[model samples]
Target: MRADRLVSLVLLLRRQGRMSAAALARELEVSTRTVLRDIEALSAAGVPVYAERGRYGGFALLPGFQTELTGLNHDEALALLIAGSRRGAQAFGLGSALASAMLKVVDALPESHRDTAAGAAQRLLIDPDTDLLSRRTAAEDVPDAIVAEVRRAVFAGHKLRIHYAAVDQPPKWRTVDPIGLVTVRDQGYLLATRSGDDRTYRLSRILAAEELDEPAQRPDRVDLGQAWQERSTRFRTGGDQVAVLVRLHPSRRDELVATALTVLAEDADADGRLRMELTFQDSRHAEWALWQLSTSAEALAPQWLRTTLHNRAAAIATRYEDSP
Candidate 1:
């Protein structure tokens, strides 16, 4: 920890030119005495650290001192390059530059490590597949430029004029003040405020986005994290509400009861099967539960659910019967 602090102190001085002991101590979570000692240790190791006295007093590194990156071995260097290349491409748009830098780093490695690195690289492929975009329909081919602009506006707290495609409705232009972006599985979403109401728009549905010249402001009481959490909870709970009783093997009973659908009651049968009463939000959810229980459990409640299950089974059997 002390060594880490000393290294951080040196880097801080290099970046900021000078820093007082109190400032360094606060950043490093140490005392002024500890910072002073670290400065002395750095100076002893020929770091050229100097301290000035008085109100403007602080530690500074001598001019022309260079920091070297000699600690990383070949494998470590290759790993860092790969990680950096992936991040740079995804986050910072430094695609080809990152790849070129990685090539140079890999070429500089020794023959043995280079061979190992090549094998590792081949085995650990990080392909950002472009094929998924091909599956999108004409309606979904919203420009990447528009998406990027919306993302920037959201981060910058700027208002946006967007041409959006609403479900079962014609495309219309709307002005929204973007709060943040939400990523749901493969799709990106914008959570925004429009006319005092919160709205979520799919990225693919956005036809165009124009950033307004006015600076953006957030509502004092609005919390994006809390809003997303509540939205998720409501979505999960809004499905069909039905009580279901199922008998599961004793071994799997505990796991079954621990699912999101609450277990209202439980009983152990003489034959070692555990009967559980559970509630499901919808028929689809109930069907999913029954599918999971196939061969291992039995539904014991709501005759309609059992009938639906039987009908589904008959349809599935008909499909197989019609198969070659």
Candidate 2:
């Protein structure tokens, strides 16, 4: 709504001091012309907004001006409360801070809205660590001291040194230019650069961390989301991946998808089962996933896999044959 946009404009200017029209438009996700019109409207409504003309000039509000906007509607307040109830903050070592902030949000709400919003938030759940099958997803543990030091380096744009435990490798200390931190499904990752090359380290694998006082030699600005996506794509495509053809029971299709990295193709067979072409990280990954399904899935190709499963089944049968 225009009213919301206008209020946001005032708040942005108040927070940022001065911003060019182009910059304001980008932040507001509108056109330069729309920003100009909004500025004119604010001025007409007795707002102390002024413009400057120079190579590095833009719009600014008079220093002492302030708006008395409460900033959140009832639904917005409820949304925030619901989001705050998730476990993401705890993964980043901010559980207590999140709890305190949530209390303050509830307290600041209008009397008519406070009780209802709080009640509504209690009824909705987000990102629980487990699902219906009673299978639990373990949350990675990172010490508070380690979290604090890593966070300091990332936010302050400084160099960070860490003792990392890489897979199949001994622990070693290395220095990196901290870029940002990311969390996905309860797992935390530090995205950084070492010797001008992209590097990602799991937070759980960081045995120790130290924030260096030296400034990081990195780009002044980074699109962290895009950077993460690119790295994920590279990792997924560069490994010694394996593709397999399998006949899977209809009920177990979802399970296979969760384990496999990608589903190359899938179609329903005449037997009402699914014919799926799947890709896994490697042959072991494919075998492990298929083994979980037991008789519900059959590996149609790669005779070696079928032989391995047969041998394992024969051994199990022989072991149970003499049971009294």
Candidate 3:
């Protein structure tokens, strides 16, 4: 651990030029005496580190000295830079760390490949703000402390207490045995359980979190990919799932199937329209999704939803009738 701290101290000085002992101590999360000792260790180990005893200076590396810690080749360096540019790192509160590491990686690259790699990274874009459809999914920012806490619990197999804001509900504290952490579409989730029931909490919705002293009740080794898939299947299958039978123009079948949660069955109607048996999250969700297609989609079953849409359309028609 001390060796790691010494390397960090040297790197900090290399990156920051000169920092006061107190500043180095604060940055390394250690006492000023420990910083002085680490500086001494670096010097003893042939590192070109020295301290200046003036008001403005404390510790720094000799000029022209740089750490050759990166062993990445050209393609590898470009790949890392491309990954670093993604917005998803903010979900787990590693955006700053990733940026810092990326800078160091760039600095460590050889002069010959550095410009080419950096330029290539600039030309590539990951998760751009403006899409052709104008749909931008913002990355979530979990408080660093809360994310760190949940992360520790997930890794160390500790029970976690979290103040979670579930959909349509107020934030409330719950103790859960964390199964695993999952990220989908730039959003993060804590796959957990309360009393053996499967639960998934959006990291964005977690107001606060603390790792309990109690160990989580979970398997010894987990296959995260399999666990995630199993949970997803269970989730998609077991809810207040609404079934709908709709007849739509055959040309629009792909669009409806793409948007539906599941397509239970399909048949060709008498007029050659596509009759689909599909499921939605609920009535409201079904209505909202169908309404987006306008006349392209026709929700035949669930008369309640049909009535609601009929009233909504009539209100719009009345406005148009009075306008002229």
- Clashing pairs for model 1 are 239-281, 240-281, 240-282, 241-281
Rank all candidate structures by their TM-score, best first, as comma-separated numbers.
3, 2, 1
C-alpha lDDT values of all predictions:
0.69, 0.82, 0.78
Please list the residue runs of candidate 2 whose C-alpha ends up more than 4 Å from where it truly belongs after superposition: 1-85, 110-113, 265-275, 301-304, 307-324
lDDT of 2 at 121: 81
Give lDDT tens digits, candidate 3, residues 1-324: 475466567667766689999998887778999988888877888999877887797888889897765444332343355464465466666554454456566667786887789789889777777789998767776787898799789878999999989878988999999988777877898888789987888999999999999999988888888888887787768788889888898888888887778999999989998888899887777888788778877888888878978888899888899645
RMSD of each: 17.7, 16.5, 7.4
lDDT string, candidate 2, 1-324, tens digits: 577667767766765679899998987768999999999999999999999889889999998785676346533343354455356665665554444335445545665896699679889877677889988878888886788789889979999999999988999999999998887878889999999999999988999999999999899999989999999888767688888889999999989999988888999999899999888887788888999999999999778878878888899899999968
Ranking by lDDT: 2, 3, 1
lDDT (Cα, tens digit) per residue for candidate 1, span 1-324: 455456566756765578999998876667999998888898888899998888898989898676652243333343355463453233322233343335445545664696688788777745344446655322233455686688668756788989999866999999998887654434567788788776788887888889886666566456768888876666556655778888788877665665536677888889988878887767777878777767687776788878888888888889899649
Model 1 CA deviation exceeding 4 Å by range: 1-143, 161-175, 184-187, 199-227, 238-243, 249-270, 277-281
Q: Residue 218 in model 3: shift from native, Å? A: 1.4
Q: How do all models score by TM-score?
A: 0.47, 0.66, 0.73
**Model 2, CA-based lDDT:** 0.82
Q: Which ten residues in a row have the lowest lDDT in candidate 1?
A: 88-97
Superposition error at 134 for model 3 (Å): 3.5
